[model samples]
Target: MTMRRHRRLAATLTALVALTAAAGCSSKAKSGDDAGGQGADGVKTGRGVDAKAIQLGVLTDMTGVYATLGKSVTQAQQLYVKQLNAAGGVCGRTVELTIRDHGYDPQKALAGYTELEPKVLGFPQFIGSPFVAAVKQRVDGQDKGLVLPQAWSASLLGSPHIRVIGSTYDIETINAVDFLLKEKGLRKGDKLGHVYFEGDYGENALKGSRYAAEQAGLTVVEQKIKPTDNDMSAQVAALKQAGVKAVVVSAGPRQAASLVGVAAAVKLTVPVIGNNSAFAPQLLATQAGPALERMYYVATPSLPIGADTPVAKKLVADYRAAYPEDALDNGVVAGWSAAQVFGEALKKACADKDLTREGVGKALLTLNAHDAGFGMTHDFSDPQAPSSRQSAIIQPDKSVPGGARVAREPQVSDAAKAFTPGG
Candidate 1:
């Protein structure tokens, strides 16, 4: 009786101990799963966001024709994220930024997007219009992430998931025409020349120029150029022969310099205006620097970084402190402003603790008349409308921080308001 009873008791005790340990493991697993399922604000999250941080991507051109601008963009984005993290990031979660260079190539941009699609919540800056167009469908359809593209084309106005921070190229060109006609005293039937790249950004600006020319009773002489073209001498010579009273350019810095420099050489003393992307601070260091200074006006969505505003001052100080070796440029301001817009949207998305891609998209659509202290306001309330039609005219001045000074305050021309997208 002693041996049999002792053996049965020992076996029962061992079985009970095993059952207790299994129950404890099951309970711990349940707790861990619950925490992982919820965000910091106790709401369910989507891709690129977790309880501790939200990850975003930046698609830019670091080794292309726009490399200087791209580098500034990357730097400003980093600075903005750093400041945001220091001030307690969105929804109590640290913000992580992943930057990928696309070299201003559509294929490279697509590849970068493919790689970043699964890792980031959204893209704060997609640098090129052509690149954005190449990946728009994938980004808007399957990826389901919000994208704020650096390209401001009217053609992009209808996308549900894309947010534009400033005026479209079309509207900016209309303003340029207005400034040239009214302020610069160009008469009716005068020939206005336009030299542009053969892509969305350039085409959109060209459309605006054409519309404005018609309205002002002026003739338009157009020359379509490619991104790779470095010599615009022939184009300038043709415009000069056509007796153009003014010229509007929609190209990058290299082409801009070439066009203006050649125009000056050929004794084409007409006023030259450019879209925002056409001017970079580095242009002043080229032989075209004198030509740019002779008569060049640039249409911009924001005041120059040299503007005497509190926000501009803060941006300059922070940018210089962060990159003392780099000169402050409009691209840095643009990048910083884009990040600010994204941060605001993130804050809105966190208001209800819904930090998913859908939440961020809705927040972006609700942003109405957001003033970044850049002397212009952006309204995202109407999805069918372009972000902002207002723009300021700037003339090149080497003394300025960004190599430009405000020539005209922010204004929305009647022609810009009446212009149609994709027309």
Candidate 2:
């Protein structure tokens, strides 16, 4: 062979290498296009989702009964979205959060939902039980978007469109009753007082109390009130006269403070356990702070802030950095946890390149024992089963970030397991 023959062979090899490189580049580009492509039905993927960003809605109370709790929830959602965006976002799109204050009003929540439904992919903070109840039908039937409701009522657990972050209020109350009987040495025949509102939130809690009472062979003295009622003196006096051993309250923070203060004034020295909605930092600053310190216990779905976990530590630090003037509130932690679950669902939906409302709903239904951080886990595999049944009992302590100290770790009690929403 001569030098000319060697030159021809080298040219052939160079041409083959160039052709192979072109094919590789084309395959990579096609994969990227497929990820960002339309669904099989040729419909747009998701509402409020585009090439640049995905928008989420928040309907919370900023100036109503649970103002502090609602505001903290909004802030926590913002912080989570910010962190997610900084970490390159989900499916290569930034997360944009839009918040609206319903002021704990059902009408206002309905209006806000109508306004935001067209613009957001989903809701991370659907605040009030009443509000969610008011709009549940429309949301489920018409809007058809995924919603992470702040209220964990048993009634809403059956809705396919709503995602609950923690244990239902009824389950929380059941665990609270169990905690009192086991930890506080309350006897089987002791009279337990139940002070609750009149709606589903209150009624659901009452159901749990009744179930636990039946199991423990205790008597429950009931005192029902409206959310508009500010004074609980008469209710407390009734419980005091009945010689109740312990009380379970399912009301707002103001009502909680009122009940505690009135109980202290009447010399009713008994443990006052409330549902998760009953505790807030503002209660610690009110005149009932001392009474809350003495008798207040809250049963919640997640670990208190400052728990020894990577997720908890990061949440505390991020919350403090984002809002320096505000203390760490469990409402915020709850909001962050909701966002985490929503993010997981979003990732799952995107995996199939179909980020529609139906896709998100399907993804949520497939979740099995998903750890939502802060020592909480959820199983959505069965639509009929409650989202979460684990709860922890905490007592008010002004020193902790969430203004409560964990008296018990999260556990799934038999009472919770036996809980049937409206049963």
Candidate 3:
């Protein structure tokens, strides 16, 4: 997700994030004064790392709006761990995750972080922009642990610890608006309707729409909604009355579906685009399927699931075999990609002979233009910036394995590249 990052499973799906806590590590890693020792490999260890294994945290939404999406994300992360451990682990140590199912609750998310903070080295998959931001001070000031969140709000950027793996929501939204413009979803002087959440995720995206509208010579019609609100009938009515040409959805899958479905029933047909988490494969089986297929589009950093690329093929096969019941989705790719980056940093830290939290953070900065053979590549050298400012436009297609196909390749729009997240 530039999603699977914020609001209730929104952007939960601008979306890819999740995983569960394993029962325990072979043995819990030492923390505080008890942490940091020499491993058999002569690697220096610290909190979350011991002679046997290293621990990370996964604070995710499992029972909330993005439950299904979260499950897929978590499973893929688990799958990555399985593969990594089987391949001799990292620097003579196995990797473990302290996963918490926050169910998209703010208090729960905060509590989960509080509980896991001391026990883990860092968090590879914290899913909410607001939730991640909630603990930003501790992470940056005190904990100094590395974090790769599923959310993409610009507010989380400019921190050394909380590194956004993809473009932030504001930048992703700018790229999305660029997609609409290039595809003729909207032209000059057209009014582009934006339906978004009132929280960090949606508000950040709204910023981008405003900027893009100004850059592209268009008017923006705004509609604010909460994550719990599912009926988009009223919002659709308002956008229709405004005579908007295209619409941008910066919420979750449910909101997108409702808005698209409601708009269709009212014959307010128009091209609708969303941040990454706004669309999911499961929605294709619902009443919104036809409408989503006809008009709904999503912008994300990675290629859609079941893409023709080698990485996608292998992942789909392995995932389907591992969990035959779970359908393929882009969440898998997002989860795997994030986990892989974490692994890369861990490997660099291990090679540096310092698997401490700070060591891992430093290792990440050394990885510029890191490519995992997916559709996107990132430069983590600058903490103040997102790794990349690019998004691929995808359209829902029931026939595809993930129920979606790429409408555009991953690229940073001139508007997006020039735009500043906090500017």
Candidate 4:
């Protein structure tokens, strides 16, 4: 990479790392050849710092459509590592995080992977499904470096080496739809409306919603929107004409925000169900109307809006002390969760005598139905092999009587299992 690109990558990576490092640790933290420690189960250390520091490469979208989200997730990774070290480092070795920006471009994703091939582990955030699919073709059926994916949905398919920290797209969507239907007491033949951007992301959202709708015997009035088109007046008009009562939206913030505005303008107020990608407050806040009033979103971690829960409180406090003026977002929360899982895996990997790629894969496969009581839970046990389909559903208040409040606490289905380390 050029010097400028390398510097840019370093800047983004440092931002994430700095977000989670405990006070006094980053400044006095040991660097280079003196940070090594035990691998699994806190075994005895072999070499000193030089042998202990695990090189972890993080590939994220430093600049792209999901750049903000990617950056958040990367920050979470930073926090995880920082905490791990503060608590005596992972397996007695400090984790050295090296971040590379893929720009949300597929070719760049490939390039990023190639550049990071020499690292001990790869923790990629916001590679998205398309980039994952491309990488999967190359990594599957091959035993090489571990690819810890931060993207959900598409990343679940193919690739044995790339372990996921969240549930599959289909499962998340199906669960969300099911929750909405059951909670609202909706029966079969209920009319529903679907609005989404005409792309892979939107299509994936549609797939989950459709599956749930079919199970509940619901009918959908589907409308597609171009990413460039912001005004959803006509789409709302069509849905209103169809007499749709509930609407499921799967699009970006800009387009989804527009839909919310139009929905209220046309007086199609009922329940607005959205996929995980559409859960940003600013997105709905972009346009006026009651779009977010009863907006229901399906997400895993229920991060308190303003540092309420134990984890959120600690996150806010530590981050403030650490990063100070930096802001936290949903993506960062996801990243933190991902790192939690990876930390567990690393602990396990170091414990096992055979700490190869296959060994780590096996350990992760065994991590089914683990719950992080801080907020969310997951269950990845499958008939086949290791799966990353462990996530829960959370609903955030779009419009509280007084600004955005915690509408609903994070809730996981009975299917989610508690994490049992070395199980």
Candidate 5:
């Protein structure tokens, strides 16, 4: 990571924060970490089978635009399960994680769900919004069946039967923009432009950005493009023509990279901000060197990057040990986080001598204090209990001070925010 990359990442994070804050309307205070609750399904466990094996499912994009994201998240979750099982299993029962590749498609995700419906106590999905939209009803149909979804669509948050693990784009971008504007000491009524791919992803981001602009008394110039479109010169030129001061990009890595590079080519020097969807290395690779200058991104925990925090260190080591040939990336962190959440839930489910879906859901609701032994600390409790809704800003570096190695370390925000599924 380079300094330019660092700036870019920071800018992007600012936008994400704002979005999360706006969309995360559930005002439930952070209930401190505690255990002992009933599962949603009212099922009970009496150490049923001494050798009972619990199977969890991971559905994600394995070979698509978001391939790395899904793969890394699944891998980390697998490792977490492996470690938990190695440490005597959850509640003395071994956990078996079954991963299904959905290729980021809703149809495939539904198919995967159908395949795992018979045997799974719960399923955690990491597919993009499309897959989530497709199977939204199906997953919720589990009905207090211990469903943990990673997608942050506001619509799904209304389901009390399910658990959503992250912040919504609406709140993330709104909070982020507000913070960044205040930090930068920008004047009131300034224009913040958005160049994004046209879809739910982009529209969601736009909603947040627009809300922030209205609250802060700022102006917005918006442009839409295809996520696969590589030539954003036109969009960049349009933003410049609109005299936009800041630009928020709501697209995947490839599109983001293209837009940023085009901004540089067209000499649009305004600060560039990216939403969570843009979190990954592909953007960095696309806009190396000067192009990365003043580029900032909002990174969720799944992208390990150069995280040296305890959780990150352990994850890195485990990944290296598990897949020595494959270089460590973001997906590993996602998988690890997923496992960490489930592991805690499983433990809570067994806390009161009974393990069941109702117990797991109750445990998750009241569960807090997530210190993954890494730099990551996610505790979810209160009206909205999925605690790991934090987002950090990452600025890549070209070189290190005092001749140290250049690495990517996210500069997390001082302000901690909570995200409720629909609240």
Candidate 6:
């Protein structure tokens, strides 16, 4: 699914320490010896920060599951770094990214983290939730570095080190179900079939489906698949056989496309709602395009890249100018917003005259109701709670700049509000 939609490590200590004198090395939050000297701005500096630049990590998928999203996310943040650097950066230190493409392999993801962990102050984008959950222990106990993942699994909540940017998977799914109910697409007696991945992302979403089903007096038809499984024929067959009125997908764009396309082929023409990572705008050009006409998905952490909002419009224009050849998607917003939040934390850290890894984490906790004119206010004060419970109900539209537009503005459903994080 959008792996953090978000997670995942690096190298030997001795070899790492050897790079300390050179530009390649970095360290965890620790004593002054491990962290380097202060910058010209007189702010205390540590790992990933030198008098000249601040290094951040980008661990993402470029050739697997979320390849399209990964590219946009990395590029958007890269654009942020460019703009920020042009503006003189935080505390006179430039922003640089140490990027690693994990290919969506868990082992490679961890290795990428390890290799880049010491070289960067923190990770602004880590693309898989399960990968993040896998290295949760290292992040909490050993690294203690800040990670702003693209993922929103409830299981990832409550961690001081890893902060999820939007409503969790369960919460978002509940909101998705609510959308179907409100639209009269589903009813009390209807069965909501949930086709989800087999890992943290899908299971977390499964929690929401069951909860919403119980609340609405509906039944949940379950179909579990893996990230590698693109064919939804069997799954759709089962869903149609079970007489499901609506469907919720908590997987990547591939799975969403397959489900919707396959569903249409089998004449199981029910409403299909997906999590944020479930749709990529590029799919609009494929054979599945017509089938996706009725597809609906949820977006959070930020609104779509092209909305009525001023910031959204500006971003769409800017991104087009920057990457004219690429297609627009929600990933650009996700990428930019994550970096925006991370930059705010850095500013706070600079203001406090402490730009260490630890300083950034502390600064981030103080950010609440942060408004970047993204049509939503994110409150990062609670680690266990999502920054925002609301998500925008979106539909695919080729006429739009990002290939989709908002159907309903961002809002939190009563059911989503009442949701508690657990499976």
Q: So what's the TM-score on candidate 4?
A: 0.76
| TM-scores vs. true structure, each candidate | 0.90, 0.88, 0.92, 0.76, 0.77, 0.91
- lDDT per residue, candidate 4, 1-423, as tens digits? 234553554465444333323221343343221223444544433212134676766778768766666766787678778888889875556877888888875556656654554344545353565555454534553323456665555435445566555555555555555666657555678888888766456666667667667766888788876545667788888989998867777765555666767777677775666666665555534555345655555444334335356776666566556666555556656677667776676677667733444445566666676654345555444423224333344444444311234434554333222311111
Across residues 214-292, which tens digit of lDDT does each residue of candidate 5 receive?
Answer: 7678887888776456677788888888887777777776666677777777777766667666655544445443575
Residue 321's lDDT in candidate 4: 69
lDDT of 1 by residue, 165-242 (tens): 788898899999999988887889899999998767888998899899999899999998877789998998899889
Relative to the true structure, how large is the alpha-carbon lDDT of every model?
A: 0.83, 0.81, 0.85, 0.57, 0.58, 0.84
**Residue runs of model 2 more than 4 Å from their true location after superposition:** 1-44
Candidate 5 TM-score, C-alpha based: 0.77
Query: What is the C-alpha RMSD, rounded to one decimal, of candidate 5?
Result: 10.3
**Which portions of model 5 show Cα errors greater than 4 Å?**
1-50, 141-143, 287-289, 299-305, 373-379, 382-390, 398-423
Please give the distance, in angstroms, between residue 280's alpha carbon in candidate 3 and its true position after superposition.
0.8
Residue 153 of candidate 4: its Cα lDDT?
52
> Looking at model 1, which ten-residue stretch has the lowest summed lDDT?
27-36
Which stretch of 10 consecutive residues in model 2 shows the poorest summed lDDT?
Answer: 27-36
Distance from true position, residue 147, model 3, in Å? 1.0
TM-score of 1: 0.90
